[model samples]
Target: MIKLGILFGGRSGEHEVSLVSATAMIHAADKTRYRIVPIGITKKGDWLLYDGPVEKIADGSWEAYALDCLQKDPARYSIAILGTGGRSLKDTADFIIPAVHGPYCEDGKLQGLLDMADIPYAGSGVTGSATAMDKIIAKAIFKDAGLPVGPYVPVMAEEFRRDYPAVKARIEAQLTYPVFVKPANMGSSVGISKVNDGSTLEAALEEAARHDRRIIVEQGIDGIEVETSVLGNYGDLQVSCVGQISYTADFYDYEAKYQNEDGLTLTIPADLPEEITAEMSRIAKEAFLALDCCGYARADFFLEKGTNKLYLNELNTLPGCTGVSMFPLLWKHSGLDFTQLVERIVELGYERYSITHRG
Candidate 1:
């Protein structure tokens, strides 16, 4: 059996969410073909080898049973697990699935580490992860690729703090009311706010700045929010069915994503014209390649209500992996179940590893 490593619960605001996604993956992964090794990274950035019940991993009680498993020695390629006789060595995982989200892990930090060790991992690499994590950079890449994107203004934390009035004035002058203020590098809508007018703009910017040094304010589009999942290496890509999220919250926020179970509604194969769906698929693939993303990504789009104009929102290299999450649901409708999808992701990871490491 292939030794499959599942890395989750990273140093991110979405740590708890990562636990849930990793739990779902562990439960759904094929046992006959793979042996699962659960590695839990605590909020404090401690890496531990967990050999507890999968359920405990979700609730986070697994930390009590985890063995400190940091690789302090560069010569040791395999993980060092603590056993009764002291520390024992375990073979390097044949393939590692990084289920971590947000900053420390998703923003290329962890991917860079894995690359240094020459390890195979599922999902995007350093460049793709870094670019996709920053909204401003991704928007520039999308715009350069000739993809349609909404207008947005980026402000550095220092710039906003030094002269709040100037930055606020710039935002007000460039974008109209009802703009989205968000941290440039956060995901799962962790630090995002919808400002209706100038009165609440500064506070919204402050809230976003709390999470990231760089913030982006985008002109709100009156459109339907739709997402499509893309998979595979650069040349050969697979685009999944479009999924629409209907949420009652101000927008798709952190609470709507992980908490408040019924706060949002996700419809697979979103009710859109054949042409629109095709366009979303086309753009999704284009965005995936444009961002240099490999393995998998979920491309969100804003379909203008009246004009039917499609605007690229952002690309998430490591989207949520729960069975019911939009990414998996979109793929499920596209003919791959949860188990098969995970297997396919691991396969793609291997494929990417081969191509990238080829000497």
Candidate 2:
């Protein structure tokens, strides 16, 4: 059986979300075909080889058990990700599936390590992952590719700190009130705030700065939010049916996404004119190819309420895989079940690796 490593938990604001995603993936993964090797990374960046029941993963009880095992039997439970020989991550698993999200896990750091170790892993490579993670960079790339993106202004944290008034004025000049202030490199809606007016802009910018040195202030779109999933490598891609998100919050904040589930409703095969769905699928594939993404990604879009003008929002190279995440649901609606979806992702990883490593 192939030793499949499922990496979960990360040094990111989305750490808890990763745990939930990992748990779902572990449960869905076929046990007979692959030897599941669960690897947990703590908030402080400690890597532990966990062998506890999968049920303990989602609620975070597995961490304590893994830590105890590590202390009692360091050689067996400890993980030397970069170390040589049998204990290293490269030697432990033939293929790795990163069930983690956000910064360190999905921003290309872990992918880079895997590349260096010559290990095949699911998801995009360094350039695609890093570019998709940074909103500023991704928007620039999209605009360059002739894709319509919502108006946004990038801010440097140092510049804002040096002269708050000047920075605020610049933002005000470019965007009206009710702009969204967000860390350029964050997911799960962490460190994001909707500023209705100047009175609250400073606090929003400051909060964003705490998460990343780069910040983005975007013109709030009064539109319906839609998303589509893309799978497979370049030239042989599969775009799933579109999905829509309806929420009661001011925006689809972290609370609406994961917590306060009552406030949100997800509609697969989003109700839309056939032409609009086709256009969205076309744009999503273009954006995925523009970033040189492989394996899979979810592209988010905004459809203006009145004009029906569509703007490509952002592509999540490593979108959430939890029970409620749009990426998996979109595929499920497209006819692939949870197990089949993950199995396809692993096949794509190995396929990409083999083609790239060919002499």
Candidate 3:
């Protein structure tokens, strides 16, 4: 049986959410075909091995679920999983299913560590992961690819601190009222604010700086949230069922995502006309290929409710995988179960590794 180290949790704002996603993978992954090794990273960046269950990770009850099995030290963060096999973490794991999301883990940092350890792991490589994490860089590439994105400007921390009025004036000149101020490198709607006018620009910039050194201030997208799933290598791609996100909490904020639960309405196989769905899916695949994304990525869009004018929002290098998350739900709606979904991710990880190792 193939041994898979399911890595989750990290120093990300979505740390709790990662546990939730990993649990769904644990429940759905076929145990008969693989040996499941549950590894979790603490808030302090310590990695621990657990034999109990993946549910604790999902429910954010990790310590409570594996209280007895908790290790005193976390020196075992690094793993020797591939060259030999998945028998022992110190020796081998056929492949790694990194259910990690957000800054510290999904932004290529974890991928770099895994590459150093010489382990085959799922998701995008270091470059693709890093690029997708930065909203400014991602948008620039999208524009270069001829994809539609709203007008915006990226502000560097140095510029913002060195001369506040100059930076603020530059933003006021380029973007209009009702703009979005966001951290260039963070995700899960963290450190993002929508400014309705100039009065809020400075405060918003200061808030965004707390999360990332660079920030992107864009024209607030006025539309409904539409998301699509892109899978396979850059050249060969497919899109999953389209979905819509309706927020009751202003924007798709942290509470709207996890805390409030009913703060948003997620409509599956979004009730868009067939033509619109086809268009969004096509744009998604195009965006995926343009960036040479591999394995899987979720491309989100903003559609003007009546006109259906689509504006590419951003691509999530590591989209959410929780039971209630969109990625798995889309696959499930497309006839692939949650377990099969994760299996494919692991297989793709190995496939990508084989391609890299051949050179």
Candidate 4:
């Protein structure tokens, strides 16, 4: 059986969400096919090898029993495996599936570490992860690739502080009210706000700046939020059926995404026209390749009601992987169930590693 290291929990605002995703993955992964080694990372950037109940890991209670899993003064990236008689043996993983989301974990930092260790892992590589995580860069790439994207203005924290009025004026000039203010390098809507007027512009920008140095103010689309799942290597990509997310909030913010979801509804194979669905599938793959993502990613879009115009939103390199997550659910509708979806991602990881790490 393959020794799979399930990496979870991270030093990000999305830490709790990561724990949930990790717990679900741990439960869904095929035990007979892969031996799981659960590794938990604390909010303070400490890595621990945890062997406790999945529930504890999901509730941030596993840190109490966390043990150092790294080799002693190791020149290379290696993990310590507990052996008989309480002895620890330095070993390397056959493969790793990082259920981490946002910042230090998903913004290419973890991928870089694994690359340095010569370890195979699921999801995008360093370049793809970094590029996709930064909204400004990712939007530029998408626009350059001829993909339709909404009007957006990138504002730096220093600039926002230096001249709030000018920055606000510049934003108002290009986009209308009800624009979305988001941290350029965050996921799970951690620092996103929907501004309906000038009164809330500064506060929204400030809220976004709290998460990252760069902030993105996207013109809000009066439409539905939909997502498509893409998987596999570049040339052999697979796109899942489209899914629509309906929430009763100012927008799909953190609370709507993870908590207080009484008004949340996800419609799989979104009741969209055949042509629109096909176009979204095509555009999803295009965005995936434009970012050079591998293994998997969920491409989100805004479909304007009445007009039927679809605008590409940012792509998520490490989208939530819970059983109810749109990524897996869409694939589940496309024929692969949750367990099969997890197994396929691992296989894709191995395939990507073999091709890229060939001597």
Candidate 5:
């Protein structure tokens, strides 16, 4: 049996969400096939083995039961992978499932550490994860691939603070109202705002800047928010059924996404013309390979209502996975349940690791 370390929770905005994903994953891994080691990361970012019964996954209840947390016994805890890496139980781990999302954990920071430790892990490598994390960079890559992408302007925090008016003016000139102001390095819509006018734009920019040094203001597309999940290593990949997200609000911000669902509706296997679905899957696969992403990625896009134009949004190397998240949901729609999905990812990670680390 493979000793699998399920890494979850971290110093990311989606930390609470990670807890939910991790809990679901732990419950799903086949006990007879794999021995599981549950590793949790505190909001402050400390990695440790949490000792507690799994209950209703809380968004933010136990930060890291420091005092009650399990003490690292060499025999039980295993070595720390010898370097900064996914602190998986090095005793064995044929594979590691990183149920972590957002910055510090998903942005290749943790992936790089894992790479150096010589441990196999699910999802993209350092470069791929970092590239996918920054919307500005990822969008640029998509555009260069000749994929139709919406126009976006990047505003550095330093630049935004130095001359707010000039930056705002440039944005106003290039994009119309109803643009999305977002932190370049965030996920789960934690620091995103849809601005309609200069007043909202200013607040949006300021709010976005608080999350990251770089901000991205993307031109809005009049379409439904549909997303597809891509899986594989480099050349060989598959795109799952497309799903449409309907937010109660004009946009699917954090509130509508996790907290409140007043205006949130999820349509699995989105009812689209066969051709459109084919096209979305094709473009999504191309984008995934274009970025050299391995294992899995959630390709988000905009399907403008009347015009029928599809604009590729950036790909998420490590997407949200809180059971209710789009990645697992889309795959579930594609016939891979949460358990199979986790197992598949771990297998993919091992397969990729064998080839790449085979030197």
Candidate 6:
């Protein structure tokens, strides 16, 4: 059986979300085919080896248990074993699946560490993770690749701090009212706000700058939000059926996405014209390749209400695997169950590693 390390509980605003996602994946993974090693990273950035009830993981109690175990037997539970030079992460698990998101977890930092340790991990490499995590960079890449992206303005935290009026004027000059202010490198809507007019733009930008040095204010697309899943390596990719998110909140903010379960509804194989679905699938695959992404990713898009024009929103390299997440649901609709989906991701990771590390 393959020794699989499920890394979770990252040092990110999405830490709790990552815990939930890891729990879901741990339950769905086929135990017969893989020996699961639960690795938890505290918000303080401490890594521990956890071997307790999976329920404790989501409830945030696993950390205490892991700490207790470490205190009792430091050599056995210490994550130092994952360090370079001796008995590294490669010796602990044959493969790693980071069920984590946001900054340090999904923005290529963690992937870079694993790469240096020669550990094969699921999802995109460093470039794909970093690019996809930064909305500003990903938008530029998409636009350059001929993908339709909505109007937006990028703001540097320094610029906003130095000349607030200048930044606000620049943004207002480019985008109309009802724009979305978001941290360039955040996910799960952790630091995002929908501003209706200039009156609220300052507060929105302030909230965004609190999360990232780079901020993006995008012209809100008055349209339906749809997403599709892409899986496989560059030469061999598969796009799943499109799914739509219908939310009742001001927007799909953090609360709507994870807290208020009833605030949104997910429609799989979204009821759209055949041509539109095909076009979305085409664009999804294109965006995946444009980022040189491997393993699996979810491409989000906006279908304009009036023009019916589609705009590439962004791609999530390590999309949530929680029960309510659209990534797994879209693949489920495409005929791959949660277990099969996890197994396929492992296969892709190994596939990429073997191809790239060949002698």
Give the alpha carbon lDDT tens digit for every residue of 66-88 in model 5.
33444545344333645434544
For candidate 4, lDDT tens digit of each residue in 1-359? Answer: 88788899989999999999999898989999988888888899867777667888888888775643234323332334333222222144568899999999889999988877677899899989999999999999999999999999999999989999999999999999889999999999999998999999999999999999999999999999999999889889999999999999878888887886686899998999899999998998988999889999999999998899999998999999764578888988999988998899999998998988998
Residue-level lDDT of model 3, residues 144-171, one tens digit each, is 9999888999998878889988988998
Candidate 4, which segments miss by more than 4 Å at Cα? 67-92
The number of the candidate with the highest TM-score is 2
Q: For candidate 6, give the lDDT of residue 246.
A: 93
What value does the lDDT take at residue 355 in candidate 2?
84
Error of 6 at 179 (Å): 0.4
- The residue ranges of model 3 lying beyond 4 angstroms of the native Cα positions read 59-92
Clashes of each: 0, 0, 7, 0, 3, 0
TM-score of each: 0.93, 0.98, 0.92, 0.94, 0.93, 0.98
Worst 10 residues of 3 by lDDT: 73-82
Which residue pairs collide, candidate 2?
none
10 residues in a row with least lDDT, candidate 2: 77-86
lDDT of candidates 1 onward, in order: 0.87, 0.93, 0.81, 0.87, 0.83, 0.92
User: For candidate 6, lDDT tens digit of each residue in 96-180?
Assistant: 9999999999999999888878889999999999999999999999999999999999999899889999999999899998999
Candidate 5 structure lDDT: 0.83
Instruction: Show pairs that collide, candidate 1.
Output: none
How do the residues 9-108 of candidate 1 rate in per-residue lDDT, one tens digit apiece?
A: 9988889889989999998899999999888888898677766689998888877666422334323323453222223322546578988899999999
Ranking by lDDT: 2, 6, 4, 1, 5, 3
Candidate 3 backbone clash number: 7
What are the candidates' C-alpha RMSDs? Answer: 3.6, 0.9, 2.7, 3.6, 2.4, 1.2
Tens digit of per-residue lDDT, candidate 2, span 33-87? 9999999999999888999999999999999999999899988876678768778
